[model samples]
Target: MTTTDAVRPTGPGLGAVLSDAELAAVRADFPLLGRTVRGGRPLVYLDSAATSQKPSVVLEAEVDFYEQRNAAVHRGAHQLAEEATEAFEAAREAVAAFVGAGAGEIVWTPGATAAINLVAYAFSNATAGRGGAAAEPFRLVPGDEIVVTAAEHHANLVPWQELCARTGAVLRWFGVTDDGRLDLSNLDEVITERTRVVAFAHVSNVTGAVAPVAELLAAARRVGAYTVLDACQSVPNLPVDLPALGVDFAAFSGHKLLGPTGVGALYGRRELLEAMPPVTTGGSMVEVVTMEATTYAPPPQRFEAGTQMVAQAVGMGVAAQWLGELGMEAVAAHERELAAELVKIAEIPGVRVIGPVDTADRLAVVSFVVDGVHAHDVGQVLDDRGIAVRVGHHCAQPLHRRFGVAATARASASVYTTADEIIAFREALAGVRAFFGVD
Candidate 1:
């Protein structure tokens, strides 16, 4: 079957909400959503930010690849190799189109973390006298600055830190506001002429805040800095067009998009990818090699080394096409409804929201702290009722520090998530303080 053939198509029209019946059908697409947990209390998964559950169509796509076409991609002229390569490349095209990119601009990586690392290390390689004049744009000088936000996940923050450490570049950052949004009010100060790179999230994974991309992009353009977007949170939850956003590079993982975990993609503008040197060197990435030296392949393949993740890419492509069939406007509208319901958690006594208190320009994600109750204790109480939530700093320690808390409990929503599930989660959350005698 083709990538989207097995997917159960549904029509929810533009800006249409997934009604109760539509939601029931959507939930049925994922087998895990129907399973029970915590002594059969019915699993209420609110942790899509951490990772998303796979639908049967995505699962089947992987299995179908391995069972039917299990040869190495872009290698042999055998029939299986041709088919595998076809499926693999088709996936790149699908994911590229999903984000408004061309297939040639997409490079496969293990995950978004690895994708970001690839770009950082490329800069490191360029600064160390690699890639010649073509890589001048990637080079960093001693006084050059790399900027990130305080709200960055460790994945986005740490790689740039290492890049600066390797290249003698300075690291700068934008702070967080009281409401957990990017404090870009002083954008001119944070991103200046010396800023060589500026990295930030499209949406806060912890705060559910949609970033002001247009404002940030304009600033980065003013300074001629390359913009890298940590799009892991936004790609699955919103309709993202990388080119339209005007980011120089963007990264997202397949697992969070309802595909397999072993695969993700990095999208670089075609010209930038050609200029950027490869971080990993091996088999398929070479154009020509000898005992003395080796020449590299073009972009995309230049960064992808060794055997590719063929089956995972195939599944991710299907996931992208699956979402396309549902229409992103509708997907976003459905989540907005869930976001409205989720924000009500802030209304619970003794609970304080860590992010925006309202649903405006945010995802269906809420992180909150309960008065006199540790976030871990709150999570434990909720888990006892078969509700899964992410507790702790959520990989954003600096952001939590900005909020004057060590950690907070975060409940996130996905396509299959329902309003009733949010209600159940809220009811369970309401009793968390009482369970610990902090009510």
Candidate 2:
């Protein structure tokens, strides 16, 4: 068949998922989308997985917090301090509800990477017996194993590697299939009795493939291993329910979910958080402090050391409310339509899609490589046409190695993405090979 014929037909127009009026309203909510670039060409933003554009409501929420309720939380007995503390905890409750978790289960962090490191360091502390009797459940020994997957982002992989290095635990991983799906065929073998933890991504950032959560959870449960989900990609695109998924802990970033940067959340089972040792200890996290010893606060507060990201958390709460109001079902349906159109990039000559060709168990992230052109060159051509895409391993160096490529050009979708924007992406991509003299 000709390359054009290989292209899957585009979905029912963007209107099928979002009506033209709805799309217009959504775009209007995000101020940055209206701007032009590269000498006045309209910007076609397809890099949501890297970081999403904040809506006006999210921006306003942050500014309002700074303007009205600007004070340290859980500190003073003054009115402003009480107000700020109320707002901060309220934001935590809102974020908890968004993930089907309890308010006490959510711990604020700088970002998802920090959250993972927090858990990893807690393990290290437990192994070192620094957390006293309460953290015995997390202690690791030399024979203990930590299971991860080959497709994990570096944030997920590196922390576990460091934890194993510190604790004398072994690190093993599930492999990726040729189609970019997780290879769970030998699940029993990988997650054995010696396994202490199982950490994996809910949705891969590089391949856009959704992991088999139920299967993975079952394996971990069978072996009595703790499960840590990297929900950085899934929480933004899918309806994520941590409690329902039965994961012991999960981490996701606010920025990827239409909130501001420098704020993320770590959702732990309440009991686990109570048992897990605090990685950072300082002011606000303590209940009593003497020069000789210190007593810590409760679960959520204990993990939040020093000054908190009050405004950022408030903005993230608003972002969660905005997505909740829109309804995750509608958002998922809209992105599925975009994914269908995006996979057709494979139809272009010399272009090879690095992930699943269909949109079944995937987000709207499409990564591809030209036969002879470098990924950066491909990104430059797309940028010249006002199409913004991510060009790199996307923090999944091992996954890129699995595909035998150094890097890929990735275009991801968000709620604001339209049918026309995707079409423009495809048109711009079609010219990449020829522009680089590889056509």
Winner by TM-score: 1
- Counted clashes in each candidate structure: 0, 0
Reference-based lDDT, residue 184, model 2: 94
* lDDT (Cα, tens digit) per residue for candidate 1, span 145-183: 999999999999999999999889999999988887888
Instruction: Provide the overall lDDT of each model, using Cα atoms, as 2-decimal numbers.
Output: 0.91, 0.90
Worst 10 residues of 1 by lDDT: 1-10
Q: Report how far residue 64 has shifted in candidate 1, in Å.
A: 0.5
List the candidate 1 regions with Cα displacement exceeding 4 Å. Answer: 4-6
lDDT for residue 308 in candidate 2, whole number 0-100: 94
**Candidate 2 structure quality by residue, lDDT tens digits, 1-439:** 1111111212234224666777788788899999999999999999999999988888887887888889998889999899888878878887899899999999999999999999999999888987789999899999899999999999999999999999899999999998899999998899999999999999999889999999999989999999999999999877889999999999999999999999999999999999988889888888899999888888999899999999999888878877766667778889899999999998998889998988799999999998899999999999999999999999999999999999999999998899899999999889887887877
